[model samples]
Target: MLFIQRFVEFAHAFPEAPAIVDASSELSYGELYKQAQRLVEVIESTSSGSMIGVLMEKSVDYITSVLAIHLSGRTVVSLDRNYPVERLRQMVTSIDLSLCLLNEQEYDELNVMLDQGIRSLRIDKPTAPSADNDSVEIKPETLEEIPAYVVFTSGTTGQPKPVMVPYRSLSTLIDWMLKAPGRAGTTLLYAAQGFDVSFQEIYSALCYGDRLLVITDEQKKDMHELTREMVSAAVTRLFLPTSMLIPFVTFNLHDSQVLDDLQEVICAGEQLKINPVVRQWFKAHPQCQLINHYGPAETHVVMEHRLSSEPEDWPDLPPIGKITQASTAFLLDDHLQPVLQGNIGQLYIAGRSLALGYYGMSAQTAEKFVTHPQTYERMYNTGDICVLNEQALFEYKGRRDRQYKIRGYRVELKEIEIVVADSELVEDCLVVARQFGRTTTLVLYFTAQDRDQDLSMRLHTHLTTRLPDYMLPSFYKKISAIPLTPNGKVDLQKLPEVGGLRSLISTSYVEPHGELETTVCELAACCFGLDRLGANDNFMDVGANSITLISLLAELRYVLAYDFRQTDLFEYPTPRLLCATYQRSLDTTQQGAPTVVPASSRKQRLIAIQRFQEKKGG
Candidate 1:
């Protein structure tokens, strides 16, 4: 059966079920179904084969309008509400939007300056239906020219790349993977609607006999609130960014009782990296299924799937796991020769999961998505570096481009965090890189501050065993808190920004004086890849990130024989501050240099140290 028919069937079967709920507003399945058809009538009333833009959040209106566009025999382009006006305008102009699903607020904000005309929809009382279903006459066309939706992604070249998806693969995904179970219905947790992954996830979830829990971005961002809802609603099936699961589990998600009926936690896009905290938690709850998936937006669903039990073979390795049964994977070096088993290379996926091609980008579409070298069929150059092991599983390495490279080394930021998280000292940590023109540095940030001396020593002792020497960061700047973006991801931009000469010290940080402060500042400058070293500044507000902190810590310790812990760095965030503390300790010993240590009296020192330690422990 066709994909549209599948969507329509689910609507008919569960017309009375609740489809979408957020805040106080609630829309039943039947009510949403009619509202969607009303939008369809409004759409087909104008142009039969035109593309309509859905500029809404991940709510009932958004999900309903998607099928409405398909029902209207028109293409739909999912648009982000967070995008800047200029970028939104560019997308609207590019797609030649015939109709736009907008609230009254959006219409007031957008209608005046639109270059290409659009029919705005402010569904007054949203129940008011337009009596016109005669406009939609379904046409059968399997030609590659047909476009289901156009999704835009940020490309390396600083331009928006649209991946035009066809109904064939979209339908195949629903028919194959999105299955209905007896007595238990899946709740489709909607996230990333602007991205193609969410589009397919959402489409397939509702199309197959399932109850969709279409969520707003605001709900997902609130981990505590979202988990409460997830538990209350007994959400069995969920889709999310893999990066989120660990932290969400750490913060609010707990207990076997909260998710007793849950069978699958489907995750993708940053899923190859295994977080020890989440892994351990999942291990404790063996019955709850955890599915780690891999595939680009160009590919629908997943080309690869790793069940939780696959870890038996990966005691020393992290793998994205084996490709799906209907898909084929290739790991070829730069010269396109097949790499030896377990040798790293660029990944190329072929067979059913490969996308039709990028929309409006003929050259780019041809370059990356092309015919196989040996066969007549097509393949997509995944750009992700990986290795095909003897077990036939593809393990992810890192990105190939220089933008991903840091300090003349291929750094997998995720690997560093994974290892640190496994240490058990830190509840959570993140590594991020900042580049100032040609110079680059890594920063490491974690939730724990007062890691015991034993914890610090153990962390240092095991660095060589777990990570490669070059991959180890030079500086360690820790913060008591790690700021999160509105979407729950770490906000890298908020990290302290280092400047010339004084860039080594974290921005806004001030230190008690000693000769060691100067030396540590120099090391901080070098770790951050700054041409000049500074003596004063705080780290967090200055933009020193988690990855830079770890990278700098490794460089300083290996290069200089100082025994510093990743935990100590957080307590004393700036180079001047940490170095000053070290210098004072040496002076107290009355052995190293005879320099006068900066002192605010012994009583004040004790109080300061107590406060510092307290801040770090939390």
Candidate 2:
């Protein structure tokens, strides 16, 4: 059944049951249904095209708008509320966006940012409650082919490709999700609104009669607050991207019982690496299951591997597991023929779970989604390279294209290179994605026309206008010329190491004064790949992101033996400010009772202090 149809049934069966809960409010199934019905009436009367854009911030109302559009037989094109206005404009213009659904706040904030004369409607709950409980149902056969929504992914051609997903695709994935073990109880909706995973979190919960807890962006950033919210809400199922999962477990799950109700955790969006921290986390919470899911935007979730065994036995790189029952996956070579069982091959998926194809890019779509020669079934050629293991399960090797997942968002390096090359600031450029301390970051190496000292800063400012934050390179390197091989292709191996380059920030270096400042600076330098860092160097300017900040927090707690909060890093991003904040915390703790540093931490501090003194002597 379609998730919308199932949601309607759930509402009628349990009207008073809680459906959505956020920080400020809770909406029962009955209230949610009533609001959606009212919104549906408004949507149907708007005379908009088939594609309806949802531009509201992540909230219950935003979800209501999505459901209303589906009920009105329109496709939802979610405009990420946090996306830059320039990027948002590209999405709106690319599709036949006839109407945008927004709340009062977004309507005011984004009115001028969006295209002029674009029609929009404000989402407000009706003063009079709706008495109708009528359900909008489409026949199964027809619904399978109808477009439900469009998800925008990075395109190799310097634009975001809209993947048109039909109702059957999502229904197939959600059906498998509901039947999955330990997926019951309250599920946290932590994914960004624009991503397809949010659909899984929403439909899998409400459609299956599980409570959906919507965490705010602020809470999602702060590890301490996120943990408190999870414990308080008793979230049983968590869907975290692999990038966030690493630091979350490393820093937050030390207390085995912090999230006593967490029974299942699913990680996707990036390759899962079972590091030591993750192993220790699972060892502490033996009852919680860790699942690794793998798929592209073209197919929601084609394969998943669940680990319920002891953490000690888990592989460092777990297999993506057998294909889900909803879809069939094949390992094919360059000839599109099935590869031998043990050989690495590209994965091709074909089944009810396949999407309709890319919107407005038929050629690109045909290139990706092709018909099998013998079977004649439509299959999506996933650029993922994989090999079958001893158990005949698919093990992810790497990507065949220049695409990379940064903080769970798929980015095509070619797209960024095209933008940078067009900036007129550089004669030629190449962008590469690299894994730095468990975090994936983009690094751009370019040869500029003028080679001015401020070219890196100028290029950085130019890219921000055209690309989103995730697509921007974390570090910029000014090379004399682009490295090329005999075939005239960019040679990635020739690029210099980003760590050995001069500081990207132009701030003058200031040596640390005291022991606390020196220790903090050393840890900060270690977190970011810098040999030496000034006290005033901004973390943001040095490629410090939320993931790195979490890693730094874990390092700080371990080395300082102080319970450093996530908010402290945000409030004081620089090394000097952070050290000052730490000193204040220490002073407060000392006035009442001295907080003893651990013996191990004392030894580490002694080492850091000794290193600082030696540098001074030199």
Candidate 3:
């Protein structure tokens, strides 16, 4: 059955059952259906084209717009508002969207920024449908073959490639979720707007008649607030990216009750490593299951491994497990022949999980999606190296290409290099992914014709305006020349290791004064993987992301004996600004003001902070 049909059935069967919940309001099945139906009318009236662009932030209206587009028999082209306008415009032109549905704020801003030829309509309060208007009847067979949506992924040619997913591809996964026992529960829509898992969260839950909780951007960044929100909403199922697994589990170690109601945690986008903190999380919450899912955008979630054994016995890198019912995976050698078991080979996926193809890129599609000579079956070349274990489960090795998954987003190093080279700020450039423990950061090495002192800021601003934050390099190195091998190809091994705080730190080195400034510098340096930190150096300018900032916050709270918010890090980004502000607060405390840090605890914390600095600085 089509997902839309199943959604309609549930809406009729359980009118008042909660369908979607966000910070502002809750939409019951009946209300949600009415809203979607009303918007369907607006969608049909606006565009005769099958492809419609959805440019908005994650919200109730965004969800409603997606449903309405499907109901109107159109394909949704997700144009993430967080993405750079240049990137969005590229996608808009690539797909040739005739109409775009957007929030009022974005409708106004994008109308001026985007292609003016493309019609834009603001998604407002959907009104009651006309009395004479009848439901649009859609044949399941016809709908199954039609393109459900088009998602853009990073391409090697520097432009984003749009992959058209058919309804059958999604229906297969949704059907599996429906049939799976004990999986029905309230799920959280935690994935980003354009991520493939967002569809899984929205369709699987709603089609199964389970409530779907929407997490805000602010809540998603703060683990403590995210846990609290999940607990309050009674969210039983979560789709988390593997990159955040350790941090999320570690943040709730002492307060395990926040995870009590969670029955399932499906992790994807990278290899799942059962670290100490993750194993402990599972040990404390045995009732909850940890599932590692693996798939590319061309095929959404083709394999899953459920960790059923004791957490203590779990391997560091768990296998991706058996092929899902929706898809069939084959390990093939360079000659496209099937590899023997236990031998590493490139993975190729077939069956119902395969997408239609890359939109309007027939030549590129043929290059990746090939026809098997033996069986004449079509399969997508995943470009992922994997080996079959004795248990018949697939063990992920690494990528066959330069592509890397950073924070759940697929990144192509060549694309970043192309964009940088095109900017003309650099004579030549190379982009590489550098691993710092669990985090993988993009680092750009460039040689400019005449290096500017403000080159880093210029690159940041230029890249921010053309690419998404995830694609931007965390560190920029002004190299004298890019090393080349005898054959003239860039030598990967010869590239200098990104070192020293001076490369990223914009401010001149300034020694930290006072216990507070010293403590801040020490903690910042440790989290940022630097030997030392300057007092006036900005945290973000020195490559502090949300995950690192949270780690720094946790340490500061423990030593300072005061609750610090993520916002505090943003307000006082530099160590000097932060410490000076806190010192003034302490000064006010001396003048009979309420003190956030008690004098007694301040002295004790000073000793602990000094010990930490000594241990780390040593």
Candidate 4:
């Protein structure tokens, strides 16, 4: 009722307030509510209780469509824009959708086969009404069915797994959020419509008829542009991943000025690798709240909230946070027995917010969503490895399996390695995550015979560009050989942990020149928290390249205001020389000379990385 009532509350109270905003458009709560109502009218004409597939880029249109589907009594099934067309087809059939909602672009792209008799509502300019009268009051299909959404998880499996979220649980969550009692004002950042975490912004803002700052999908990925919005907007609450949240720390860590208006910083997705960001916020303003939320997609929203001021007692309530008031966490051993505190175990979450189950896979759903033998309540098995403390708060360890988080982005390591295997430069590759000094960074080791690539920079840059910024491996290492076990699988544990970066980047890179270059070189060296940085020293061995590295780069780029790629550092290995080369490149491009973009350089460097990968077992 609370989630359903949220729309009505916002419509009555803040009709004129902006509910969503993208680059060139703004939709007020009133308009959004109206559109949803119209959509409801359209849905009653179709099969009742059918799932409405919401597919499109993140926008006010996409957001409004989802609420409309929910209001229409139809469950919403979100289709991710990032995935391929073939994947959409496979997932659609798996869910057995009755109706699919589409904007023109998505309709053509997906090209859903007409054989299944799936109904679609084409969003076009409205014409005169049909004989089906407007007086007909339509009841919502979900009134009996109860499902509000079906979300797909991005995991190691090639096929996307659908998780059903019901209205009762959603209502429970939205009600609790509205009652969470905060200051008079709260603002939300609308990052993406499909991702469940985006709700922290939407419902949080809708709670008090507060403003929702909707960044377009393009702007969300484009941090340079996003920075402008962050400083300029009159914002208070920011919900972001640790990697995305790192920028604020580097820029504001030393500054005494509190975000002035910024109040609560809710971090979810991946664990917080860097502390300085939240530490600085709390230091600047004692009242500022920094909440680290950890839970799986099954939990409707985050069931934990950990707030700290000045990081008291260090590592106490570190890593991740505790369960929320309405939620319960479990630390289950290998046999599913409850584990003691500090002993690593698989985390299971149980609460009103627990999702219904996997949409189609009943067996898989039964395996994960199990009834706790002791409490007799349903609990979801989270594949994450962590421990439950005495206070009941959960701390994250790593994954139970090979899946890992990089810069707060959930990554299937083998997926990235697959891309490497397909690329020409990689002969053999193994990826491992190394946790040192509270931060877990990724290290890649591979071997090759006749290498022709600058393996480190190419792989780093290639992965960085293709995936979300957080998924980029912080440290890239190419090795002459990878350790193998008797079974011939790469023996990850036996590999050298300290000697990776130099081989990746220092192969043939030269340093840059001049004051800007020199200062950058010095700043990078200092920022690394390194004892010493030499021309040939690799960042892998010295604990370099991370979300922190991206943050540092952003600051430097803002000052430089000149566009540069992370790969640029590969070409100019040393600080001094890299800077000098960057300056020269800028000058050359400015004066009408064709930019001497290095294609061969990227190709060759990738070859070196591939070469090293091939030697993994040889």
Candidate 5:
């Protein structure tokens, strides 16, 4: 059955039940159904047999447009309203879109940006059927045949590639989610509108007759505010990318009762690595089930692993677990033959949940979607390297291609290189993912004839127009030349490290010199669990979290009688900055005395250092 049909069934069964709860308002299933029907009427009047783009924020109107497009027997193409206008225009042109459904405020702007032939309808505004308007009827069989939605992923060629997901695949995903363990009374929709996982959050809640809480962008930006909303709304089931889950778990660990209603926490978008902090979090909250969900946009949620109890010794990385009944996964070697257990191979998936293929890219689609020679079944080459363990669970090794996930979003390194190459300032560039503890950041290396001081900044501003913020490299390093191998290929291994370069925090580094500087450096190293730390080492790069920062602040207060706010660690992350700021504070307390120490006071400086050391020894 189609997801829309299930929504219709639920609406009729529980009309007064709350279907969607946003920050400002709540919509019942009855009201949601009526609004969707009104949107269907608009679609029937303006277009037929074409994909409809829903460009809006996460709100009731956005949800209404999605349901309306599916109910009207057309595919829904999700367009992030936050994306640049040029990027949205490219997606529209690539999909050959003739009509787009948007909120009222975006109608004028999008109409001006899109081609003249394509029409924009305001789904947010209420519309009534005219006297001459005829009811458009779509058979259930026809709805089953049409694609449900289209989601775009980063392409190696620098263009956004769309994946056509059919209704059957979506239905299968929803069915599996309904049967999954820890099914709660309320599910939170926190993913971005354009992400495929958002569909799972929307449909699973409606299909299972659970309350759906839609998080607003304002609340999502602040973790403390978002946690309060979750507690107030009693959000029981949540799906978050691993990047977000780390902070959420950190918050829960600090309070231990921030999200008492959360029953199930599902993490996806990247590989799940169980760190010591995460393991400790699970042990503290044994009541909450932690699930590692693994899938691509081409096939939604094929494998999941659930841990109800904390293990004595956590694995380096979590297993993806057995394949669900809705789909099948095979680990095939280079020859497309199934690999034996305990051997590494590329993953190929075949099932009813497989996507229809990449939209409007036949050659690319053919390369990825291949048919089995003997079985005659179409399968998707997932490009993921995996191995089956003794228990037959798939353990994720790494990607077989250049594509990698940053903050739970699939990103292609070549895509960043392509955008960077477009800049006139760049001669050649290479982008690579750098891991700092649990966080992954993109670093770019470029070689240019002229090394202007502001060249990196200029290129960064230019790439923002062509790519999303996640695709932007966190650090840029300028090189005189790119090293090459004997085969004339780029020698990525020989590239210089970006460790000491200016990062997002500070423009330059200054070594610690004074006694206070030395003490702060030692304290920072102890807080971050490192034997030694440089004066320039970033706090975030060394796996510092809110809990660590709090502990460090408490220690500083006790040891040196320093009262620094928690925000100080974030604003002044490096030891040099922290020491300098503390000295400034001390000077201010001393009635604005000379800020700089006199060079002539060498004996006085030595005496002060001696007194400070004696105080510490006491």
Candidate 6:
């Protein structure tokens, strides 16, 4: 009810103000409220429970459906439109969902997955109501008991577990956002709907009567397009996951003035480390405030640290500043006792911001949510290892569980193992994260008598259907058997190094032939720190970080005299693929005009030798 009450207030205060904007449409506060009213009537007539499923993309309709469900005193479960059919079915069956609100496009596929008794309504194809209806009347006390939304996160059992968040918790975040600096103006809702950070973008903008700009999945994947959309929309407030933010700030928007109007940029979802590239960006853009937000899905953004001025000294990782007024965090050891200051301990969160616990998993709920020994308050053990610095700020160490972040996505090693073990070619599987410089690659070690090449292809094909791209292991190694410790457990420390395994990229070598191909290949080899590079080798596998990629792109831009997007590196990872793409672009440009080489013969020789090093005889 608090969510609805705030919407009603916003509608009354700024009825004509734009509330949500997507590529195709825009909805003002008044229009949004009217749509929600109609949707609430439909939901009340069809659903009897408090939880409803919302299956739609990031658009105005999705925002309308969420508000309608909240106004109807029901919790909204956001079902991602991009989820595989099997994954979607699992989520639908996991909860006691009786009604699902979907758009016309997704209704058909999702309809087949729902039970016969469960109802599915397409918001886009809504039936006309007999008459205009008033808003649902709910007391403030009743609103306190209803959950605002439910989000699912990776579980240890290789399945996603749901965490129900109450309305008050959401309201607390909105209230804080309203008072926070640079709260006004358009905020970009760039995160996927399934992520809790997306909720911050949605509710904070609507509650404060600020414009909320939405980007499609395609735009989110292409940093160039997303930057164009942000600039075109005059976006001021931005929220991005650390993974995306790194590339955007370091490469895509490196020298662009498109985001000069940005007032506040919040980075969350993964750990925020103050690397050289990130520090350089902060120094370049001092007008905007850079905030590092830290919290789990259970407690949405309970801690915030801001970097306003250029940093004189760099730290390994940014501090997760003071806790919010709505929550309290403790550093406890394995025995649940408070650890001494500066010592690493498991983080425990307590207070109103805590979630309602895992849905339908009472045993897991009891194990994770425990009563504080001293305060007699309910607390959720965050399995993250942390320590309190001398400045009294919480500093993140690492996770205690087998879960880690891949491109800002929370991935459980067991989850990958579960999927891999389902393959017929795999006898047993052990997945681990391997770090080389700044890049982290997931490596899968398995027992298979077949050749490594055969098993790798087979496992990759099989897992592609079951898992998302980020969750896929980058390296696959076939071992006779998993190394076991004296205690008969898998010896993770003794697992084969990633370098010893076959590179996931194509192994067959392809030599560059044409002058253009040769030039591009030489530049790529320089960026990767290799003497002789093959066309089939991947830039990432050869030690190309974000910084190196940016430098490579800059060199290519000057030599080719053609603008290139940062996303090109991801789409065409190998030198062979990139050379082909560049040739195609050149062909298109030269179709109507005479061909002219951008670089002179001597200039090309100098560019090729920029980073080339001569090999010495051993």
Local distance difference test values of all predictions, in order: 0.59, 0.81, 0.81, 0.61, 0.76, 0.75
> Against the true structure, whose TM-score is highest?
2
Clashing pairs in 6: none
TM-score of 3: 0.89
In angstroms, give how far residue 613 of model 6 lies from its true place: 19
Clashes of 5: 0
Alpha-carbon runs more than 4 Å astray in model 2: 125-133, 179-184, 500-522, 530-537, 558-567, 592-618
**What is the Cα-based lDDT of residue 133 in candidate 6?**
57
Sorting all predicted structures by TM-score, with the top scorer first, yields 2, 3, 6, 5, 4, 1
List, residue by residue over 1-618, the lDDT tens digit for candidate 5: 667777888787778988988876889998888777877877888887569988878888888888888778788888887777767877888886878888776777887788898888876566676343233355777665467888888998889999889888998888777645443378888888789999998998987688888887767755556777888889988998876664466445555676777888999999886644467667776677889999999998899998754554667577988898768888988889888889999999998889998888999999999987667788999899999999889999998678998877899899889878888777888997765323566778998888757476788788878787677776677888888999998888988875322332343544567666766766665544444566877776554654346546644653455556666888998887887898888877876554334434433433433343243221
TM-score winner between 3 and 4, please give it: 3
Among all windows of ten consecutive residues in candidate 3, which has the lowest summed lDDT? 609-618
Better of 4 and 6 by lDDT: 6
lDDT of candidate 3 over 272-300, digit per residue (tens) = 87655578778999889999999899999
User: How much lDDT does candidate 2 score?
Assistant: 0.81
What's the lDDT for residue 580 in model 6?
A: 81
| lDDT tens readout by residue for model 6, 1-618 | 265687788787778988888989998898888888888888888779888998888888888898888888788999887776666776777788889888878877877767786788888774766366545575678777567888877776767788889888888777776645444589898887778888888887888778989888877765558778888888988997775554566454345466777877898877876544466566666777779898888888899988755664656468888788778999998888999999999999998888888889999899989998989999998889999999889988888788887766677788778878777677788988865323356778888766535577679778876676667776677888899999998888887665422233346557877766667776666544445567777777655655457556655654555556778888998878987887787678766432224457425544434412221110
Worst 10 contiguous positions by lDDT, candidate 6: 609-618
**Clash statistics: count for each candidate:** 42, 0, 0, 36, 0, 0
TM-scores of the candidates are 0.66, 0.92, 0.89, 0.74, 0.83, 0.87
| Candidate 3: segments with Cα more than 4 A from true spot | 125-129, 132-135, 179-184, 451-454, 499-523, 531-537, 554-562, 575-618
Residue ranges of candidate 6 with Cα displaced over 4 Å: 180-183, 312-316, 436-439, 449-453, 499-506, 509-533, 538-562, 565-573, 580-618
In order, what is each prediction's RMSD in angstroms? Answer: 15.3, 4.3, 4.4, 8.5, 8.1, 5.1
Mind giving the per-residue lDDT tens digits that candidate 1 earns over 255-333?
5456665667776665333434355556655666767667776775555564656433324234677766556788877
